[model samples]
Target: MGVKKTVFKTFKFILKNRLLFFLILLILLGALSYYYSENYYLHEEDPSSENFLLNYPDGHVVSLEGWVVDVYPGGFKLYIYHHGKDTIFDVRSNTNVSVGDNVFVKGNLDDEKIITAKKVVLKQYWMYIFLLARSALAILIVIILLLRYWKFHLENWEIVRRK
Candidate 1:
């Protein structure tokens, strides 16, 4: 009798505040969508062009990630020594990259083997930091909402399931 009463009370509390439930669901969905878009749906322009490769056999579209050696309004130059070639990429863009910062670039190479950057990814490390912060925020919100409306609080190892 006591278990039945407890279950009934819990169900009543949750069902009475459908709006809160919806809000929690929406926030969880938002966090999930954010992860999805970053991981799966992100699209970047292909730097490889047949014209560039054909016209200049020495240079073509390449993806390079290296330390920024110099910066200018029009573009920045990078130095990659990983392949032991000590290759220099003179990318064309006024990106936020500064000297010594590691960056990823996708661009076409000119006759001189300089890459004219089509896209630049800066501070790749920050992406992971932002993801963690965003997920933590979403979880915190769900916990708060659950405590307020459902009269339920989660511990470190609690699991939630819905009927």
Candidate 2:
């Protein structure tokens, strides 16, 4: 009987403070998400980690996408930034690429950490900016439409359909 009364009281408290309960739930989920993301790239056994890749023998084929840091006569230096284990891949390719350009390279990693690229694909920076602009416009339109159809009732702390 005592356990039943305590359980009932706890349930009543949760119902009375439903907003606080949900806020705490959301925060807990967010914290867990952050923790998982931060550790995901740093795992020792993960193939993407620098330590894991360093153990691989020479002539291993790999695919990488990163920004071109430098452009020289025969090839360019590709800067792959991943979770502070940043690496600059010395890529030897015939593909015409400029500094600050995003490129995807399928290549072989030599013993000296150089990459002999078999294929190089250039990703234009302008296209990315255009995509972001379009997304922002679409999001703005959606927000406007939502506001037109819904009204927030401060008295009840709820969103009600506009009549």
Going through the candidates in the order shown, the clash numbers are 1, 0
In candidate 1, list every pair of residues with a backbone clash.
75-93
lDDT leader = 2
Instruction: Give the per-residue lDDT of model 1 (tens digit) for 21-133.
Output: 67878999999999875665124244333223334435555666777888888888887764244566678887887787778887766645577777788864466468789
Candidate 2's C-alpha runs over 4 A off are 1-57
**What C-alpha lDDT does candidate 2 achieve relative to the native structure?**
0.79
TM-scores, each model vs. reference = 0.40, 0.62
**lDDT, candidate 2, 25-140, per-residue tens:** 89999999999877875553323435334565467666677899998989999888765777787899888888888888877777556888887889867766787899999999
Model 1: how far residue 45 lies from native, Å: 12
* Cα-based lDDT for every prediction: 0.68, 0.79
